[model samples]
Target: MKAIHIDRFVSNVTDLKPSTIPNPFSKSSQDIHIKITHAAVTHVDLLYAQGLHQNNRRHVQPPFILGTEYAGVVTHSPPSSSFPPGTRVFGGGLGAYAEQICVSEPTIRRVPSQWTNAEACAVGASGAVSYGALISVAQLKAGETVVVLGASGGLGVVAVQIAKAVGARVIAVVGGKEKAEVVRGVGADEVVDYRQEGWEARVKALGNGGEGVDVVYDGIGAVESGIRCLRYRGRLVVVGFAARGGKMENLKVNKILLKGVAVFGYRFGEDSRRDPQRTKDVWDGFMNLVEDGKIRPVIYKEDYWGLEAVSRALEDVRERKAWGRAVIRVCEVEEDTTEQKARL
Candidate 1:
């Protein structure tokens, strides 16, 4: 087994490296063993690696495996569980970058039969968050207009596609032409390059009846500007602050009230235990969109292969040179042991 861990916060991407890890398994009968094949890299992962995220109230130290989401094949599980042995699954698990890890059965979801390993690893985290913001928090209705800030990044790509899948017109906000192209390719109805002059004017001009969009799916810490992009009684779904160094800042309450809109802070996976039905709704919506071919995660594969390339993935995010959400190819998908035994 192999995995990546860091000793301390450092800006150098090359400092994180893969090291040998012993095989880990479930301590109880309810846990399932996963042979990880791919791990998704996010901007939050980069911030934590750099020791810049202030949310670590736990004083989470280093010399720890760095990922929380992964996709893999199940090698061991109790027979009575929903997912038996040999199930292919994707979801959250501690120390997820490792070659093998354990997770409780409820936390993982079955990977769609037609999806690839890389897609599964990337979708579970970002897809759910996007669905929760658009469908749950904002209650976005069909044929409405949505403005997705940071439309080329991980969450932004999903937000754009999800809004489109639900029959909403999507206006994606990116920094440049490169990001605009990517956002458009992912089903955004329109692309607004914030780098250009009067970009907000472009956003405000797209509304049908109101002054601006029906909802703003903001992941870029642009709460101030995103509120202005929303129409009357519209919603601003706050997902992240990657655009502002992962910090949560002040919001203009006056603007929010003046527009007669709502602002909801969405931490999608955080409320799963307390609101299981809501979590299911979001996950089901994402799966439905995926099954219907209306949405699919765009995987970034620049200089990425095996666990060693995790650093390169993070570096790409830091430099803003990556294609989309970075996926580390952890290992080859395991062959069917039953078929192998028959051949033997």
Candidate 2:
């Protein structure tokens, strides 16, 4: 089978190439087999490829497959598994960028007919990360004010929508005017440019006076003013550290202590490993929202076809040129509005 291969760590996207590998599953194996049709390129792809991510249970040393999100049709499944042959499904697994993937049946979720390939792929893990942090972890409540840092990236875009869907007023913090616009288009009540000197203060003012926002969803993982942008007892959920070369910032323990605030670090990979049932529940809930039109994956509408186009797609996401979730179409895209937002 053909799959994406990383020769070594601390490398560039140019180093990523397609390579032939042995098929890990057979017709009677317990694992489910899927022929990937769409894959989402995430910022973590760049971080891990460059040898920078902090949390790695297996201590990935490269010379391995690279990818996490995939959506396609099931080719084989045991009768005990509800996902039958030719079933349309999407989920997260290591080395997901390949043409074929073998994973446990629990890792795959049946894709609803109304969802497009891009939407199904986004729901695999990235969108669930947002839902888990906001709904499951943070316990975000309706009518509360929250701020989403990096509110225009892949995870950030989903965070903004999830917060709004739950009836919370969102103060989206982005890096520039263009990102600000993207946040607003997705239902953010206010957009604050992080580049501005007083962005944190902007977040505070929009909250309930000097108290600040009720929750701070910092996917950027910077203690860079995000710690001070929270209300008294407001929760700070560390979603990720995509900025600063994937290295965590030096956070002030005093801030958490003195502010009487709560700090939590969230990792989707770790959560999936420790709690598969919770992972399924989160994915199912996120997919339900997508089906009901309460939320949709805002995809970066760019033509990415064949495995050969993978590098360009990764580069587009790494360079932040694509606005929303970056997806690679392995087959022909069938519809609009279901997966991707209209490109202007």
Compare the candidates by TM-score and give the number of the best one.
1
Q: lDDT, candidate 1, residue 37?
A: 79
Give Cα-based local distance difference scores for all models. Answer: 0.80, 0.79
Summed over model 2, clashes come to 0
- Backbone atom clashes (below 3 Å) for every candidate: 0, 0
Would you estimate the TM-scores of all the predictions? 0.92, 0.90
Q: Cα deviation in Å at residue 125, candidate 2?
A: 0.8
* Model 1, TM vs. native: 0.92
The candidate 2 region of ten consecutive residues with least summed lDDT is 335-344
lDDT of 2: 0.79
Q: Cα RMSD (Å) per model?
A: 3.0, 3.7
